[model samples]
Target: MASVSALAQVDATPRVSAAVTMEQARMVDIRSLVPDISQSIAYAGSNNFVGAPIRGYQAPRCWLKHEAAEALARVDAALRERHMRLRVFDCYRPVRAVAHFVRWANDRADQRSKATHYPDLDKSKLLGDYIAPVSGHSRGATVDLTVLRCDAHDVDCEPLDMGTGFDFFGIRAHTDSPEVNAAQRANRHLLRDAMEAQGFRNYAMEWWHYTLRLEPTPDTLYDIPVTAPTDSGRQAEIERLMQPYDGDVPGVSLLVLKDGKVVLSRSYGRSDLERGIEASPATGYRLASVTKQFTAAAILLLAQDGKLAIDDPVKRWLPSLPKVADGITLRNLLDHTSGMLDYEDLMAAPYEGQIRDAGVLALLEKEDRLYFPPGSSFRYSNSGYALLALVAERASGKSFPEYLRTRIFQPLGMRDTLAYVAGGPEVPHRAWGYSKACDGWTRTDQNAYSAVLGDGGIYSNIADMARWAAALDDDRLLGKASRALAFERQAQVSSTPEATWYGFGWRLADGLQWHSGESVGFRNTIVRWPKQRLTVVVLSNRNDPTPYDLAISIGRWFMADAQAEPH
Candidate 1:
């Protein structure tokens, strides 16, 4: 989460979208609307607020029509009179996220998290109960909110104890549920009264939902277009184009892919700082956590060569590593169950000298308490992956970058993708990564950790990602078994449903296997829905969560297009 100070009253986005002709009705670009309605966060942070950091929490990443937002805010004001205000859960959800929700709602395989949230509700009927056949927020006219009350000064909001939490899907979340306590009932009423008073309507089952009496942009929800911008290009353009829309972001970038045709893609504002460059399918940008997939692929390739085993204990490689719970295996390290301390946090604690993988391990040794036993649960750990990079180095007699060059990157003909740095040959058509600092659209300080290959360090474009996806699916990289394992449910997370399935390095969301990468200067996610033969790849150099939601919306549009076809 970002270190937030007091902010002023409701901020509205001010932007003048470059004209979109009627034939090309501009779709909602979530990143463009992030400033107005998002909670502030540090770049590449774990801003879960509720769970283990929400995987996709970028803002200005989305937009709600002006009238719809104002109506919702007025309702929020009404609740304020009752010493309550609507604490928004989500607004202007991206089309991509809606697609993800649909896919998850249809996932009949697991009824586990549902059981935990709604013990009284039948698991088989959740789609009808919680999932909407179509989402209203996609129209940008609805919002999700909960009632919170505190001192008149707007401090310490005590959210009423509703039977179910914000994202919970069950009868308990119903506004007039007889199963709830008086306090819960009162809370639900306050929420409903506030919204209903302001020309809004509530969804009976969810107390947190309300739709604007009128949608401002009816019949015009946009499908974010694809582009390739260096992180610098997006940051610069967002300030100007989004300024009319008043976009405020920590950072952002555009993706460019060549070869594996992009039927459609995403971009923000203009890529050229001087409004010179137009992002294309082949623009190369920094690949933050996306680097992990490459790192994981490299390891699998090593394993295929009989150099390392997935089951090998990490201690076997990094012998000097501080001791952790004995059960933690190499797989745990790769899968993020190692229970080692997050090396980033450890590096921050009154440390000495330049921090490296060894320093990180020392901190983990100091804090060996496990969130859960290895293989029993999953928690994302950059430290775990970083160690794998080192392990690859030790096991194979080459640097991590060199190993990838000789083994994975080179073999697959991913000529453009590399662990790029400042001194390298000027990256062709490279989009610069930028931030809206006190200055403006200035290049972001290159991520200190960008040099590390495991967590985030590789750099490529849309073209490279498409190549990666194709290889993972049908290429002769590591055989079909290795690719299958990459997309399967490897870890069973208790509270985190979307990421329950994590293979080697990919996070499985619905039927789509994907992972989101965020860093000081870039945020990106690529989902390959093999079942549907769809690939939604969104790469932004901005360190915000907007791209994840944006990618999901793009997926929905494609699915809709497919279903409406004459075939």
Candidate 2:
């Protein structure tokens, strides 16, 4: 219930100094004190909610006050006795980083990190409970950490599931939230018990956050950068890795978020080839199947409001549907298990023009049978989502686009996103799709079947997509239970590389929840490693190959060291 005005009332004050000698004399690197302790300094990399290295984190290292370091080392030693080790995510945050958080919170337009951290609450509410101009971490006595299991040799450590990822800005991450499973709650209790034994007090809102009961310098905030002297090479390496996406031809807009923050946002190519408009972060491209998730979300929202139940028969909302859909429920439609026939397949060859969402439902009414019995098997069907959109309209008494505009897009602050309709308002900063031609790039923006609203038809840019990604973190739009249901694996779909399952609108594979979009001249993919808080969104204007491979490669790079305990 936090409002933007409340955030504005908080004072904006700078609170740090650049004296290196004072910091060096008072602080010791936690790793130096406890070399055996595991460390994954999230703020030092792009894998945090901020998405980039925080202002003061120059390196992926943990530093703390001498006393805190000694006490943490004891915690590590004690954990080792039980075949576990203390894995620190953060320690001794710089005051500059705390200030960065404050600035981010104040910028209402910058909701890029909203989905990953503060999904259920407005940015304004975070000022007092979550973020502030000053932080206990700056005192060099506070730490954010988790427990990890180690092999007999104390190597190959893996993090235990504590219900939510570190820095998860939601109630699910609370130490006492009952939303988590029993085992997850137990893991959290174990961490709390261990940390408290060493004079560390856990912050109630954040399971991984802890502060010393008796800090050495509670009043002093340090301004020292967290980077090591040798980190220049690493910075150069990151730049080199992203150099390929810089150009002026029909280009790609890539936005990578790790832990809900934009770690990489690059635009390469042209937004308009005829006008020679260079593509940038504002470039909007049509998202084909990527739009399905939003459609699913709308249905979920209606269900959340008691307007409808997911288990209700499709006929409850759309009485015009054929009798074959009698056994099909809305949940079946959301998860692609409705066994609905593909509308595209039903369309006659040499299609006349673009088809809209209502037209899709009309076409379905003419069909006498389904591809399979409802919930009997798994088959990806665009028809299922299209119908769900219609159901949302019938239940809410609003058009699909209007429902999303007010419910999902506007609420999440996705200012530049929309469900594209044939005669709808023009999309701002639109990136026309293109295909490679013998002469050059050929504009092939929309297909004969492109106007469909539910299955695809959503147009969005990187900035808006980042907000959409952040909304998945908590229950501001959907309750925690509803959000969980969206990602819950409903049926087995494939078994390549690893088992793949179909959730509400997501394809789950090997700890990744992802979906790819493909249109006539546009190809895009959004991959989310939820547990790692890493997301890769690749949006392209050209009809190139699917961006799935590139997205996966990037996801792996960001999650290179992220390992969870075996299920």
TM-score of every candidate: 0.53, 0.57
Model 2 RMSD to the real structure?
A: 20.3
List per-candidate RMSD values in Å.
20.8, 20.3
lDDT of candidate 1 at residue 474, scale 0 to 100: 71
**Global fold similarity of model 1 (TM-score):** 0.53
Each model's backbone clash number: 54, 12
lDDT of 1 by residue, 510-561 (tens): 6767778877656678776667777777766444454766666556656666
Model number with the top TM-score? 2
Query: Which candidate wins on lDDT?
Result: 2
